[model samples]
Target: MELLDQYSLSWIIGLVVALSVTGVIAGLMAGLLGVGGGIVIVPVLYHLFTLLGIDESVKMHVAVGTSLATIIPTSLRSARAHANKGNLDSALLKSLAPSLLFGVLVGTLISGLVSGLVLSLVFGVIGLLVAANMAISKEPAALAETLPTGIVRHSIGTGIGGFSTLMGIGGGTLSVPVLTRCQVPMHRAVGTAAAIGIFISVPGALGFLINGWGVPERPPFSLGYVNLIGFALIVPMTLWTAPIGARIAHAINAGLLRQLFAVFLFITAVRMLYGVWA
Candidate 1:
């Protein structure tokens, strides 16, 4: 197609190789951080799009949407792997889904109305805050033994879904902290977050498809903003590698897991912040 003509064959091959590598890292992040790899995927897409010389106006939207699209399979794989270890919280998964889906729609609507610059700032700032929180690993003030019920669940789910959709991330960055604060163990929090990513990513990706539909200057092989080629090449690698991260997560000590994941978050936080300027 016309999109294929935009680059030389060798270049396209190179891009695929690079994207495959991104998928591997994304899979590792999905397992290690339970953030559904969206954090890694979004920024990487942004950079790759820039390199590909895609139209500036739609680059962020395409990046976010495609990242969300790829997240579906990746999340499914990572969650299943985590579940195999009996780490997931089934009750929490049921409670979070409905509200999270609603919030994703709300966030998608909001994204269409805002500028890409604003979204970049939002993602950067929030990512930095989330990374800082994880790195610190402070115990919650109340050390609440049970997850809050009713409106609190709504509040938490809505916040995670809306924000994650906008930033093209799984809701895990927020979910893990919430679970841990409720006195769930760290491993359970990670496992549960992996499951929650499925809920957030599926509806969130669909919302992006609908919201960005028919917008101008989108790159080829795209449904709304989700890039077909990128999705095709990345999903398998993500599926292949997510289990590796899960294996490592289960094998690592709590303190080691915390530190390993903290360093990743910190590095990604800086990369996201840099997106604003780039």
Candidate 2:
């Protein structure tokens, strides 16, 4: 049976194998760091799409949109696993959901309007920030035990929504750090961040769908901004692997994982920046 005709059988097999490996790596990182797989997915997809001769002008957008599309299922799986482990904070989720939802909507809209190069640059910057956070070993001395209220939480939620959507990242990169700084335990913060990914992805994805509606250069099997082909390849792989990552998280040394994750982020950041410039 011919699985894919867009390229040679060898190339198709290679692509599928690469994507599967990426899924495993991204899932492991997400589980170990509480991040959305997007940090890894976007850069990898960008390079892969370039190799496949996707248009330079729109390849970044496709990468980001497709990453977000995959994150929907991946995040849901991660959140459920964390919840089962009693790591998720219901009250914090309840308090943060509204703002997060609104932020995603706004961010998606912004993404539709922005250029793909700009999106790539933004992602590079965010990746650097994540790397910086990961490199820092010491926890902040001043930390609050309670969640922020009033305007602060709303502002942070909005920032998370916009940044996450723009880079096709799981909100966890920012959310986990913020929560940790707010005195939440690291493991609990990771769980909460996983839950936030669901809130960010749903509306953010809808916005992409709505915004990309009439664009003429969209790929085969696409809905609005998202390529269904990429989503199909990634979603199942990520979902299946995420729980495995979670299981490993409980069994391994988290500090080592975070350092390894930081190294991975640094590499991805450099690649993304290269894509933006080259």
Candidate 3:
């Protein structure tokens, strides 16, 4: 048990403040970096749950599920902003939708069976990889002149959705890399990936809701694994800030921003991994 388990007024105030900061940063990353903010949100939620004395068996599940739920609104706001800026790749998004949904379903099912330790490991490993890539690569050269199709498309789309669901992220974290590899410009890659997040998040969030139903040891005000209070507090802030990130993404160079974010991810990833071994 932790100090916050008592849920005193001071604890409540502290929680709100923490959640508010999380939402603001998550939203900014969603719009500015094309990630659904799951990368940021999941670890934050995990630590918060730990502080609240949430059972280790279900804390990671709750974190992932709740992160997915939050991505829905953030993705929508970010995607729309990207569209307005003429950065979205609609054709590619349409082609990938079905597979993404299928993957989310599959991932959600798997999450129900996996232990919290395993989930933490997965998040940590993926976060480390993503952070390293961002920190090391100044420019990702195009490997192909066009988007993937047929089996490749199916594999990539499904993988993006499944992996993202498992990690509690929107598709952007993976899809942006894939798109850039396919020769999509940075702006369009980010924009299109933002749209792809919608496909992954909507279905992923619902799948988590159903998957977590009747599960034991969930935090208070939880509907399945999604904490209603966290959802409520985070959503409004994310929605308000996402578009601002989008505007900034379109207006300026993001290389420095990516570098700074990579550093943050690296630290977060290490902490997550350490928690697993500890």
Candidate 4:
């Protein structure tokens, strides 16, 4: 019994260490790339949950939910840093808010009905496409000279929100590319997307909280699908590093940033896909 207790204690320590490291990386990614760190957080949490012997049926749900919750603070800090640097587009942010919220609601509802495998598939496929685009086209041509208005803009915002929620992202991965395609500069797009993450994460997290309220086999200290322990473990490190990341984003070359982001995401996506198939 003593040996078993030691083994369990060791596992707990290792998990905590891993989560701390994940938080650091996630914070950097959120600030540097406007990704809200959800892309990094979700996968790491999923793997950790698996190691913890969480039930397979709800593993992805918890990961996604917890990721959205963590993003709230990281995105807030990242956006504030970018705003201080005059990188954010306040007008664009205002226009997209309503539709983004709407889409998050739609996504949360969908999440409740899907299997963990399906969510993993969505994450892998989208991650690959986003990575490929970033890798191949550092400076994509503009599709329009200015941002769209009315129904067109709303539709795009809705899609970004829905997809991001499904993937446990902050909408930066999709929004940055779309903004750039509309003739927005890379840095501005990135900053704007960081703000956009706020629109997605708050409502998305709440939705997950309500959606998973009574689910079985959740990790200890979970409030619905969001694991409080993971949130607590990850938030502090991300809070500490996120501002630093935002500063680095402004200093770096835009093209190099895209390439680096692409490489990291490509590896992550490939690994996620392999997990799905394996």
lDDT of each: 0.79, 0.80, 0.84, 0.85
Ten-residue stretch with the least lDDT total in model 4: 2-11
**Poorest 10 consecutive residues by lDDT, candidate 1:** 134-143
Q: List, residue by residue over 199-247, the lDDT tens digit for candidate 3.
A: 8888888887887899978876678888777788888888888789989
TM-score of each: 0.84, 0.86, 0.88, 0.86
What's the TM for model 4? 0.86
TM-score of model 1 (CA atoms): 0.84
Shift in Å, residue 241, candidate 4: 2.8
Model 1 alpha-carbon miss at residue 159, Å: 0.4
Q: Model 2, range 2-72, lDDT digits (tens) per residue?
A: 33454577776666676676677777666666567888788888778777766776777877887888888
lDDT of 1 by residue, 176-198 (tens): 87788788888989888878888
Q: What is the lDDT of residue 203 in candidate 1?
A: 80
Q: What digit string (tens of lDDT, one per residue) describes model 4 on residues 10-58?
A: 7667767877887888778766865657887887788787777878899
Work out how many backbone clashes candidate 3 has.
0
Query: Clashes per prediction?
Result: 0, 0, 0, 0
Query: After superposition on all CA atoms, what RMSD does each candidate show versus the true structure?
Result: 3.1, 3.1, 3.2, 3.4
Ranking by lDDT: 4, 3, 2, 1
